[model samples]
Target: MTRTSRRWAIAAAAFLAAPVLAGCAAGFDATTVKHYSPTEARATTVRGIQISQGFVLGPEPGGKLPKGGSAPVYLSLTNIEQQDDQLVGVAVNNAGTVKLAAPIVLPRDKRVSTSGAAAPGATPTAGTAGPPLVIEGLTKELAGGEYIAMSLQFANAGAVDLTLPVVARSREFATWAPAPAPTTQQTPTTGPTPAATATPVPTATATLTATEDASTGGH
Candidate 1:
């Protein structure tokens, strides 16, 4: 085609596409929906045992984690009793016996292995993975004792305090890193001497690179 004819054809195609594009965008505004939801007030609990899964050992607030990350306490819980109960507030104690103000949330997931996990002393196995509900901003609350302890407060369930066993938390598996091999250091002293009878000393320090056990935890 001639140059002028080609230009005219291009203009005509542009004009034809305008209406189609306009139609596609025409009802977009009306189809858009507004979203709204009211802020929910926290719930209160009446009565139920405060059960937990993972055990927080001498856990401390503001303490350092291994990977230079925010230290967090992994948690899960349930009412244990048949009847449902409300959960209210919680009190936390740091490495001391004193109490600290805190909020308690029994963030339980039915999708998880209900029976928390085996204790860390078990064999290694595939561990659980899921969205963890941050119970709350946990910090040291109380003072008096040398160790940490948390007391949960509820409206209905005053002190049906429950003890949730420390299930295994297998970052890699749902078991402990296999029981540590028994050391020979405590074997015996060839000849006993009062001052020399200290703990058995190994000639060399050897690091374990791999496990020799054939069985313990599942892959």
Candidate 2:
């Protein structure tokens, strides 16, 4: 072959192989890269119930509760099922007792919230108020930027466990304070009264003796 033809052939081969070499260096793996973005809230769905925007409000300024103190959990639940379901109980690991004042009835195609104003309903315009799930008798002091494992029990859906985030009480969460503890009225106690004592009648005898002495003196 001629020198010029050989040089041209070598240049062509180099140009064609450059892209293949680059592709190999960049890794030809077929896996897709997943990008994660920070979110202000989190959510999960179990059965026909959608539990979203789950968060815990931090204690008030200088009002942080010690270990064994309680906190409130806020979340919105939506029932997509045709039948109604009831939220029977809640549990937290390493946390205090979880108590719901009453079972939460989730109507079909309805959303229930524990933080914001309730949706307008029939009859009265004030809407229906939903109570928050309170965690009483905490086993550890809970603060902002922490997470606790919690499980929710439903009458028909069984249980759903989640890792809920703890956020400070600020901005939107400022109003999500825990419900006031129930007050107890104590009955007043009474003590026994002592009986009155009577004085002796000897005073009358002394007065008579004095009068008799005065009459004798006058005589």
Candidate 3:
């Protein structure tokens, strides 16, 4: 079967159309995750697609932490082959995200993803396990030498060992800008109104009321 056909078939078989799992609850095997470095990251054939260049993120912009907070980690990927390959699917810790790519991996979750680090949330039931974590979302995108590092994961891919790479993504392909600082503005005091001051009194009468009024007048 073709790449797209293969993905649709797998998605139909495994997922039941739920939002992708996210947060620390993605349930990655801690042992397996500790070993996938770019230098040693290996690829395996699912159907016929070869997956490689795996890396785990320290923290994403908004993903929940192990015991601290949340930061959405961008899962980076690359196709080592000269031919343009198709990303069939992903199953990162049972989490999923609808991708924006033909072989997609952006926005981070689709279909269904695990929630957070063993928090008081629901989790997918365990079935037959696959060696070397294979996490996939929707779609796929990669060019030889050119890599895609976004929030999406791959279906039949990831590192054999989980020591994911800590490389930062280049700005050449970032689509969003960081949030800007808020601007502060203060209203200026109208010390003396031009119209009021301009109309000067022709004469003044000395009186107790005048003194009291003058004392109460603003500077």
Candidate 4:
């Protein structure tokens, strides 16, 4: 009822609400946002090598990566070992060949990524600084949102198998570049053709008879 009592009640209410507002702010912190978190890309660790954001770039929206065709691969690798390593090979089931543009050299404690700028805040490295991964001659058709069996080999780290997901070229993946189409090589022709030979003409011979003229003179 008094003026001082009313003021004291208002101050107490403000003090109590501050803590609740602070708790709510922490609940919605930007760092906790889903976009800032790791994506749905598959990840695994093998022999101290960390592979993340590993996926196959599937066909365009409403399309499928045709059988006997090709698709691009995107991933990031971090070598946690002291010595360097190299990605020597890659294989996919129902796929003919998984081609790496160059030897992916994983420097010690460095990160290499094939997805080119997909990994946020990833630094450049000998392996990640170059071209993309391409899987050619797919034996089976692939639509988006599917997983395929795959294996990766390292010179020193040995081989690691994975079930990599095939994602459509939409949303966050839309900005990521796709692997270039496989080049078609023509078969070379055989040696030049042989030439035809010509036949020789027989020589004409003419014999003159002088004996008839001599007989006429004698007569």
lDDT of each: 0.33, 0.68, 0.32, 0.73
Candidate 2 residue 196 Cα shift, in angstroms, is 6.1
- In model 1, the worst 10-residue window by lDDT is 34-43
Name model 4 segments beyond 4 Å from true: 1-38, 123-131, 184-219
Residue 74 local lDDT, model 4:
77
How would you order the candidates by TM-score, starting with the best? 4, 2, 1, 3
lDDT string, candidate 4, 1-219, tens digits: 899999999999999999777666765322122121134577788898898668888766777888988888777888898899988889887767887877678888877777656477565434443345788888888776567788898988998898877777776777776767666899998997888778776443322345666778899
Candidate closer to the true structure by TM-score (higher is better), 1 or 2: 2
Models 1 onward score TM values of 0.27, 0.61, 0.24, 0.62
Best by TM-score: 4
Q: Write the per-residue lDDT of candidate 1 for residues 1-219, one digit (tens) a residue.
A: 999999999999999999677666755322112111111101223244533343332122222222211112233345555554444554444322222223333333211111224223221112322212112332433111122245555554575332211112223223322211224667665875557557877634332322423233434
Clashing pairs in 4: 113-128
Whole-model lDDT, model 4 = 0.73
Model 3 C-alpha lDDT per residue in residues 2-98, reported as the tens digit of each score = 9999999989865753323332353443222232343343333333233333433222222222322111222223444334433444333323242
The residue pairs that clash in candidate 2, if any, are 96-137
* Candidate 4, residue 133: lDDT: 76
Candidate 2 segments exceeding 4 Å error? 1-39, 61-63, 119-132, 182-219
Instruction: After superposing candidate 1 on the true structure, give the runs of residues whose Cα lies further than 4 Å from its correct spot.
Output: 1-47, 50-52, 57-63, 66-70, 95-147, 159-219
Clashes of each: 23, 1, 55, 1
